[model samples]
Target: MSKLDKTNEHEEHTPSSSFSREIEKEPGGADIQHCIQCGMCTASCMVASVTEKYRPRKLIQKILLGMREEVLTSELPWLCMTCRQCEERCQEDVSLAEIFHAVRNIAAREGYIPVGVQKVVDTVMEDGWMLKDGYSDFIEDDRDDLGLHTDLGWNNEFVKKIKKRFIDGGNKK
Candidate 1:
């Protein structure tokens, strides 16, 4: 109610920054300024539903506020499923999934990737799949039980080309 209290309230709020504006200059990243903090994206996020830590709404706010290191170093950006459910329901039509991807790209470039993500990349690069290379003894029995072919679908040649495209191409996927 007092003048001093009003001024303190204004000072408590940090200013938005040009980081998001810079990102907006890139393709598919122009909607950063349109976020209204409505929490719709958070509510609709499949990851957010399960994890209290991976809120895209809060991440966008941090980006607009220029908390670059915090957002870049955290595992939050990698957690996005890119399902587009948040974008579909957003009132401002902000490309939430794209924004997340942009942040992830930035983080990855800076060598801030989480260990789990690195493992996934390594697995795909080495085997063209998420699981470990080579088949298990039980796998054949399971396939037979389901009346399926015994082919484990490990195409070494195709995997080699994929590895060259992604790993040898400066991580281009």
Candidate 2:
């Protein structure tokens, strides 16, 4: 038998099928099967433009070949800026951004989130906001300074009720 046929026969009985099954469980994975191996994505990627090692084409190839560990652990997965440039440039409209998002979620589920991303997640969880510098402290100009009436029937009671509802609903972090 030919080498290709022998390899296929060997893979049929191997644990590699489990990795294939896991990849199938990913949402939109069916789209991956339709990839034509065009290098447009890698050509248009800004990261790939600057970095010799960060090519989306190589990523697609690895995923197609079921290189689970390499695809998941590579810095290339986290290097995506989510710019959608690759998606926009794709002739197949393959949703590369969605694929990257799936990869990131898988990495996170496997407890592989990089320290920088984990710090951002932790800050958001703690502050209920993504700003690392905390809320801006701009002082509101007084009504007198703006030459307007200070008491224009603004209802403090209504504002208080809204604040109480938000706090009770666990949204007041």
Candidate 3:
């Protein structure tokens, strides 16, 4: 191969370190540099098996390649199930859950949250949790079919204290 051609190929594949560095600063993402791309994480990832777009190894590659905007702006980071299957099988002991969580934190702080994630956050902020406020109609029917009690013995005082400590504290009006 010509010298010019070789130089061009080298320039094209140069490793961009900024994004990886930024991720390393987050709480659980410090272990990202240890990943060896051995594919064990991918092989053990339940999300990767079912979803064509949610490959954990590929996500790490993106960050390592300094694809900062692409990593933060995409819905791919939000697809982690946090099952820790990949972490368990990792050769490098990298915590995929922590990395994903850190990515999600960055994404949220950057206002890049997907619609479904925003809805869950809104639910948690408003109701102190998701299921309690959403478990009336369809959930009750399922519970009845299974011979379970449909009446929700909810604790309003607990909810009130949580709202005071967090939800109410945040609101200006």
For lDDT, the strongest prediction is 3
Better of 1 and 3 by lDDT: 3
The root-mean-square deviation over C-alpha atoms between each candidate and the true structure, in angstroms, is 11.3, 10.8, 11.2
Model 3: per-residue Cα lDDT at residue 8: 23
CA lDDT, every model vs. true structure: 0.76, 0.65, 0.78
lDDT of 2 by residue, 1-173 (tens): 64335432322212233443565468744345445677899988999989998988778767777888878877678888878798787766566766777777787888888787888889667554565333221222466677766555645554444444443443442
Error of 3 at 37 (Å): 0.7
Which prediction has more favorable TM-score, 1 or 3?
3
Would you list the rank order by TM-score, best first? 3, 1, 2
Q: Which ten residues in a row have the lowest lDDT in candidate 2?
A: 7-16
**What's the distance in Å from true for residue 101, model 2?**
1.3
Question: Against the true structure, what is each candidate's TM-score?
Answer: 0.69, 0.63, 0.69
Clashing pairs in 2: none
Better-scoring candidate (TM-score), 2 or 3: 3
